[model samples]
Target: MWRCALPPLPRYPTVDELGARAAALVARHPRDARLRRVGTSRAGTPLWLLSVGHGSRQALVVAGPHANEPVGGATVLRLAERALADPRLCEGADATWNLLLCLDPDGARRNEAWLSGPYTLGNYFRHFFRPGFLEQPEWLPEGADGATLPETRALLDLQDELRPFLQCSLHGVDVGGAFLELTRELPGIAQRVARTANRLGIPRELGPYDTLYWPTLGPAVYRIPPPRRGDLAAAITEAAVESTWFHPHPYGTVTAVVEAPMWGVAAVEDPTPPADADAALRTVSHTLRDDTRLLEEILARVRPLLGCSPDVARLLAPVDDYLLVGPGLADSWDPDLRQGGTRPLPPLTVARLTALRLAGRRVALRTAGLLHQLVTASGHDPRGVLPELDRLIDEWCADYRDGCGARWIPVARQVEYQARVVLAVFDLAERDARVRSRSGETGWGSPAAVPMHRE
Candidate 1:
């Protein structure tokens, strides 16, 4: 982490509050900070990019890439404030900082109800909103629907214009612990991140998550998986063409995707291998299938009444994807084996499996809640299905609470952990640049051939 200290944030901000903070930075440092209207959201909200410093190289920091993961919004504002106040931050990194306040303002606005939070599990799901994969700005496949979201176009435009050597996208999870995905393996940085989380008493997420399939560099650190055309229909894969794959540089841009959990669960931190490994996998798989069927039945009842509401469709896409894709992709895993017939999974694998199972339950409950919201918003008497959905949501929520014993992580700590990881990545980039300079190679994309693991 850098010398500048970030005070813990009390709460996540709304999209407008994030914008206001960005504007305040420009006001405070008018000579150094330049706020640009890069593009407009689908809702016609102006998207702002706050550019600070005039270093020879450039670094892009994107917050709110996933709407519900708003911790990054506060993280971005704080980092911008620090960059403006302490010019050495950009000077040391030798890169200009371009911070995008929020990528998906439309989706972020939908989640505003929970942003200023009491920070409870129930309160979060009640107002939660995640767009369908296609509806997402950066992840949407090229020409899949013959159109691109304005927000996505803006991102592409910015990438082309800036051609940053380093990019960090801020993201977080609802529960579990913190994890990171890096495009290029930077030695010592991942260990530093783990140490930072440990120092803050935040357990590194060892469980299965969206990027479970990616290659691991160390504990809670992963190399981002390359895009595959075949993964398009997979429920767990989410998108075949992720935002990280669109770098403009020829060699490669070092991209870091930081995921901090809002709630901490002990189950995911345990590294002890499970005894009945096959049975555990089977149970997780079985529960996912059963829940998918249950949600399918619920959606069937309201399919006719909803009248093709795009918002409802987007809201239900995750559940729908699970139902359509079968017990494959996101939900399926084979046991590890040696020359011996079969081996017990590693402790981290077991923890991930447990987390994945519990995550399925959360997805089911969230889907039910969204369904109830849709029915009520449509002016229909939802009593017919809501009572059942409510009961399921309550029972599943209870199961989630009891199963994982997840504790609400304070927003302040979450921001601090994220900020530390970002700064670590920045420091790694700076160190790599110096190494390249010493080696007489001044290319933007070619990071010095640093070892993947270095203490």
Candidate 2:
């Protein structure tokens, strides 16, 4: 948090609105704010970067790295506004601020329907639009395929040019609670972040989800360790992070990721489970296998339905390919990873898994929706899937609400929690820099994770 009274959290802006506001800052504060076009998005919307303060060191805050996570944009706008109004925001902190307000404008635009209020579980899942894990701009490749997305190139170019000392990529998730992913355990960072989150009443989600495949620092905070070559599939781990600018810094850059959830489950932080340990694991494993088979069946039904239409065929390819890859990945997880390790599973963890499944279903529904859009635009419904798909979506949404009733964190508080964690990371980075100047050694005081409890 800044050292002054802050304004009320601004309304969550639409992609277009965020861009317009970014541009507006330049005109409003000609002396303190300057805007530059980084590159154009896939849809030819100009990607803008706003700079406030002209300090010796640089700190880059990238918001809305993924399409569905517009809360990041709110954090960036507030940071930029504060830095401009009071240069001391970064004056003693020894850094200039570079804000990439909304990285994926085109995709974020697709989510504008839920960008503002009515921030509930049902409304969010209904309007969600996250690109495939590997297809994200934050981790896209530098080769021709990744180069196709102008947003990726813009981030790559900016990262290469600035070589920032501290980088914060803003991201949000739909469930469990607030969690963070960072490069390493920077000294004082965890405690500072904990304090901020506590003050804001954000329940720290002791991970049983994101930490399933990654290393964790403490409660609610996980570390994105450098990937080992054979840790898992190159596609899932390596290719997915080909151009993340935070890593490989000569001196480690204090990078942080805030994954604020749209909902909170107190059970997520508890270490107890409602069912027998082995029974829970078996059930989770069984459900994943069954769902994978179900997805395959849906794919089989969908593919031949689009037989002759090349355009609709293209629209369905992602769902088709994902069906092929998804099953194998689900099978690879051991029973422990599927559920919890040897320990009984909690209902909140189950809800987390359900949320993930809901995400997959929505994505498939989107592909089907796109097919409908294409067919309708062509004045035909060769596949006749619109009504069927609509029914399926409704059934899934109703089931989700029934399962996780009234367990949501509002839009405003989500932004507050994320912003507070980011500021704490920045503060930690400055402290570390000063430490290095005197003792010439890094000391984050974080020990190697032994996983004392099952995540």
Candidate 3:
């Protein structure tokens, strides 16, 4: 038996705690790890990057780029610890992998408070808000007027100095499960990632660029248009002009913005598995170990060809545009959000009713199913209340629309639509026999609903 020495998993740490923990781990590890102060947040928190591995000129740029997406940070930290503890993993991989983890300290910190608490639906809704492009330290809008945040500047400097072969910006979403989107030049890499997720029983999907509900600058990038800005994408494009002043790397760079939904992992665990703290720790460790192995295998296939692919830049052009433009209801030609601009919200149709409702139900079932799988994978049956909850959400949206009349539906309509459905599910889980019998033991309630405020 390879006795695992991993400690019991703690609740997700806050950004400050996570950074401190990462620093301590790096300090304790065997490898020569150096911490670099990359930049500072608007709040003045210092953003740090840990550099490990020695010899190969190639760099593996990985960052928990999104604030709420903490798993990637956890994964990177764990992977670093493992790599340091066992030299064998890095024996042939030395110098070639300079990992840049946690690029957004401010965002990460903002998310930490929620992570330390109970992982409930209400908690997530209350705390989670995507940062706008200008809000992001890495993004520079046109005519910034000398308002560059420190974190952004540091990242630019790091990019210039390191000039890594690949940049992997780790992000996560609330919907759509586990999938990888890469430059079309790296389709094989995406397929490999999808296959790995599937092998682990993680829900996987593809074609994120084409299937996004709204325009996305990149796969995971979200941009908010400026007030009175008619051409959202054009404004973004114009904003990019300011980015030229901060170009860090002389060589063209290809960035892959990856969004790994936490639901993917939440969905696959054996619901009824042993709850003994020690046993749970072991189970999670083993699961992560297996995941890492799969990732390494996929990387092995992609690493060798990065330098020689002449079309890599060309293939990445569209991806770059997508990220820079940030998805919107508008596009390059039309950016106005008011004039039913470029990317109008996905038309509210019966089709969306079906998709949104299906999604809501699946999420509910997946939550219950995950717990069940963790406890007992074989006889697992997610409670039936989720279906009813889904129906309620669909009906609520339909009713609301009918009452409000057709020509225009506010963005708040969609937010309320999702929230109402979530609330219905939580309510039923607390009362219904099927849901009560399984998840009722735990008092999971919706977070206090915040009324939409319109001026």
Candidate 4:
């Protein structure tokens, strides 16, 4: 096992720091490492592609696919530093590592306020900013009119240029347990990754699964469901297609998404079934509905007073989505009382999941904060619905922090777990490739060839 001795990062790097650090890594190893300007962000910030080593097999690692998930940015720099320090890392896999540093710089900058943290729920939601799902670069639908972001274009261009065999997008959650989602079930990867997380004391995310609809391979590991064009379920939720499904490689790209939590608590991984599981599930549904209703009520009041500020528009986008679709989503969680034999969730699992939903509610209310800012930015008093907005924001932040028992997961530990599993997957891919080569098999590893773990 390659032990990563990552020094504790005191705070997450700012957008400027991330760029400078990436450049510094390339400068340190001029011969083996090269940095190129791939595309320009919407805000005119440069997008960088850092290449380490010159092996034939191409692997694309994307950091900051979503703006708020900044942990991956550090992971990229560390991995690049490791590769540059020891050529054998890439040499062993016979792979050239292409790292996209800060894929969504525009949104990332909006989130920079909380990046270097007093990593708390209050600080996070106070400075939080996430564009709507459609606005997200990774999930922008193909050729949507005036919808494709420049960041998305850069990613698509790079994917086409590299024709990579493996692509890994680093993603993290605000408060929950850790989990991994792969485009397909690659052999002998999930178990190794899960076991490593266990050894590192990072509990496997057992509840409120981000990939709840996907097929599960094991605890905390899931196979992403195939994206069907115009799926009714997705349409109802206004969910966009994931970037993993859009690879242009003829050999087929195996995409892995690694999610770690920013905050930690015991209940996220508790397995004991709840005493009244059905009721617990109902509480989850009710809580989300109530939060959604609150946001809707606030938005309705401020809608008439709002202006055309781009920042306000960006912040409001997801709020609109949630309000439009949140009801259906909350309703989707309702357990079928009519169905007799359905399994019930554990009490702690329900608590943690509810807390996770509350964390999201806190994020959603950020629109109100931004709205307050926008009104004040124009030199007008933010009095009308602004006081109510401030109250809700504080109320929800407190609810999430105290109710969830949220604790900051150290930056070093997060990097360690992510780097370990990522390297493990790379090794597994190498092994799988060698096996296929021995059998005269070619393009695309078959999903049915091997199970994710030994039964």
Task: Tell me which residue pairs clash in candidate 2.
Answer: none
Full ranking by lDDT: 1, 4, 2, 3
Best by lDDT: 1
Q: Show model 4 residue runs off by greater than 4 Å.
A: 1-8, 143-147, 231-242, 245-249, 336-383, 440-455
Tens-place lDDT digits, model 3, residues 146-188: 5466666666666655654344455554443444333212323
lDDT values for all models: 0.73, 0.62, 0.40, 0.69
The true-versus-predicted C-alpha distance at residue 279 of model 1, in Å, is: 1.7
lDDT of 3 at 282: 34
- Give model 1's TM-score versus the native structure: 0.88
39 in model 2: Cα distance from truth in Å? 1.4
Root-mean-square deviation (CA) per prediction: 5.0, 6.8, 23.4, 5.2
Worst 10 residues of 1 by lDDT: 446-455
In candidate 2, stretches whose alpha carbon ends up further than 4 angstroms from where it belongs are: 1-11, 117-123, 140-148, 229-234, 237-241, 245-248, 304-318, 333-388, 439-455
Better of 2 and 4 by lDDT: 4
Q: Give TM per candidate.
A: 0.88, 0.80, 0.51, 0.87
Cα lDDT tens digits for candidate 1, 1-455? 44433344589988888877778767877887899999999889988998898786778899998888999999887788678677678776567888998899999998888888877777787677877667777674654234388888888778656766678999988878888888778889778988999898887877556655667788888887665554555523534564534444333357888888898877786778778777776666677667767877888888778866677677667556545554453244434222254423344456777677766666666677777677766787543887777787777766767777878888888988998899888888767757765786543533332222212
Error of 1 at 190 (Å): 1.9
Off-target runs (Cα >4 Å) in candidate 3 are 1-10, 60-62, 85-91, 94-96, 143-147, 207-230, 233-253, 264-455
lDDT of 3 at 436: 24
lDDT value, residue 192 of candidate 1: 92
How many pairs of residues in model 1 come into backbone collision? 2
